[model samples]
Target: MKKIKLIFSFILVLLVAISCTVEGINEDTALLGTESSANLNKIFDISTDNSGKVTITPTADGAVSFKVEYGHGTTSSVTVQPGASTTHVYPEGKYTVKITATSISGATTEQTFPLDVVFRAPENLAVTLNKSIHNLKVKAKADYAKSYLVYFGDVPNEVGTPLATDGEVSHDYAVAGTYNVKVVALSGGVAKTEKTTATIIYNAYGLPITYELATQNYGIGGTFGGISTAVVANPFPTGLNTSATVWKYTKTTGAETWSGSYSPLDSPLDFATGNKIKLLLYATEVGKSLNVELEWAVGGTPANGVAVLKVANTVANSWQELVFDFSTIAAIPANAKFTQLVFRYDDSAKGSGEVIYIDNIRLTN
Candidate 1:
């Protein structure tokens, strides 16, 4: 009986040992060296507005380790647990987003994809100036951003990675004339970008430029030349009709000017900004004033369109010089270019049937 009991005990011991060995072998599980595993399912998605901001999202919720790899050793990381997602933002550029996940089973996995970030370029860039010779500034705005990249030339270039929000810039012109301008903008790594160009013309006032000088019926000592800007009276009247005739002259410079009433004067000589325009007039005879009247025209208008500066004062023909400041003329509009000059004289009221003569009419610096 004792032998039988011992055999039963030995059998029990053997069964216990087998159970322990099987349990330990199962617990000694090998690490899933390959990324493929049900414990870890990693996924990544990237998107960008192209305006310098990019977003990245990953699938695989439980304790996920996230990261993004872009150009030049640039990488970022974050982690989210079980059945969830995470986000990341970046500036404009190309990128590779990566996400990693690990499970309670002690196994890990990872995935990667491309990402693009960028901004749109500027458009309809233009220029403006306060005064031709005083101040001029340039400005531009982009469709998707507050700032811009500025360039001056027939073509456009980004000065330094386009500015984030201040796309506006300015420059001053030393002399007056015309110029070409351009601008560029960047967006979406490579989407919706544009460049713009325009022409810029500058003119200054109060400069010493060539001008036309006109006069009415050549003065008393002059000739009785009738002039219509439309008709050029070749060989102006060589002889005066002995009797006095009303005369007029435009305030101009140089000898190219012809006494035709409709002919356009020499091209306007630009003046420096803030320069004042003065008119000098005198009577042909002493103590003989002919109620002088003056009118101003811009870009060659007829007798009345321009600002008119007239004085009805009786004068001593003895060279009465009247000074008129065109810059302050009441009838002349501001910012308009000068074109024509006119003069008329009436001596009948002064009881002098004698025609009046005028001379020394000028528009000068």
Candidate 2:
């Protein structure tokens, strides 16, 4: 009986000790489960090199690991441990970032953050425009610009043409007028730089007044005491003058003795190539004097003006070629530019309602 009691007492003591150990383990587990993650925060560092690079560091009170969802696209999530950071490159836009932190006790906390990434505007924008008649060429350059857009401003609701930094764009206008040209520089983001300028398109007359171009503005008119002057079809297009058009001069009855007609040229006469002006003339009567003169539109004097007079007409009622030698006046100032051409007929007598036809006015050696 004594041996049996001692064995029972030993078994009861072992049971009690095992029960206390199990209770102590349960209490420790409950305390750990109650301690949840808190105070989750993040730090973001953006690069200044315009590369759109961002470094992110996350922290929490009880976090041991993290799962980061960048929320920009289909990019895979990143797994980061405590005291570590991750980096990502993003375009210029806004995004929402999701962060999931896991605690040591298997508890998780999640939060969403709003992120905005903006780019800087381009700087020091410079644009170059060149015009040749009706054609225009454009080019542009700027700091931090990736591309360019050009608006020719000739059409209504025009779409911008794309251009590269090292490239040029060309446009041909249909009509002659002034147009506004705009160039925009882009930085691959919302920021941009723009510039605007004006360009003129017209057909400029230089030498050899032919009156053949339909689009050319000849600036033909009568000056002082003449009746009128105009470009008309060749009344007698044969022999020396077979051209389709001719300049007609009408000397009204009883007009002044110095009555004349004039035409303006786009630029001053250039006598370097030739020193003679040749034209075809038609008259109703013989022995009529004709004069051709050159005068500056502004600041002109007798010293700089030049004239050539034909003593009498050799042919009557027919086309005759006449040459006016300007070599005598070539010694005038080299910079003297004459912009106007004057024609006078029978300067010594009053007009008797005489009409004259002229054609093929050109410069020759």
Candidate 3:
């Protein structure tokens, strides 16, 4: 009985010691760390710059260190001890900053806040010029620009206006002249400017060609003698103006034919509408009949595939203005390009070698 009682007492002492050790371990664990919502107050200094710089300073009770996360990169973080300030430079953007406060016992509490880094002025700005519908086409480009502004200088209406992101815009000048062009790239309302100058040329869209400009470009030629510059006859011929010069051609013996050929025009001649050729003629005899033919080119070869219209000189000897309506002839293609102008007079036996003055020969709408 005595030995059994001693064994039971030893077992009781062992159980009490084991219970006390477990309680001590529980107490130590409970004292390992503490967390409170007030730790958020540690974020005292938080600032950013338009150039993408951020500075942070955090302080908290019982905080051994801090982990600053910029939230731009998954593995981007910085570890700093308590009561210290750290800085990070980020790109211009909106971000969420996550700050983790770590206790001495390795416990951590995270606090996140919104961080905005504004944009700086755009960089590498450039401008290009083009033409559309007789207007100056301006296109601009830049790096890191949200939008652009174009100033077509000298025009009050378009001097300063916000433009699209693509930076493409068109402005028609009132006249042809040299003008300064300005382009500005904007980011967050900040601007970077560039300037250039462009000279604009006038385009005479479908305007009637003057007799001087025409004869110069097409060049007067044929079996007839070369061109001689002479003033128009007085009491001005029907189509002859006082200011215009006349083309004097004396007929040759062989065919009694004369013609003027034109180079391929800048814009192809449109014969769809008022396709008329007018000429002022002064012949030595009246009732002198002539064949005026219009020839067009197909595949670069002048062909008479369309009927040739000829208007006779019913009234002559004096200056008479005559019109040859190409529309009276067989249908030429609507957009046919006439390359050659032909004139033939049959009274060669009578009017042969007779000087015929041609003035103001022109093509019109």
Best by lDDT: 2
Q: Tell me each candidate's TM-score.
A: 0.45, 0.48, 0.44
lDDT of 2 by residue, 107-221 (tens): 8999988888887787899999986657889999888787899999999999999999889999999987778899999887899899999776656555677777754555543
> Per-residue lDDT of 91-168 in model 3, one digit per residue for the tens?
667778888878877888788878767666677787788853247887777776766777878666765767777757
Clash total of candidate 2: 0
Model 3 Cα shift for residue 65 (angstroms): 13
Decoy 1 TM-score against native: 0.45
Would you give me the overall lDDT of model 2? 0.80
Instruction: Compare the candidates by TM-score and give the number of the best one.
Output: 2
Better of 2 and 3 by lDDT: 2
What's the true lDDT of residue 313 in model 2? 76
Model 1, 77-138: lDDT tens digits are 55655555655555666666665656555456666666655455444433332223323455
- The parts of candidate 2 lying over 4 Å away from their true place are 1-30, 47-53, 89-92, 130-134, 144-146, 175-177, 187-190, 201-362
CA displacement after TM-score superposition, residue 257 of candidate 1 (Å): 34
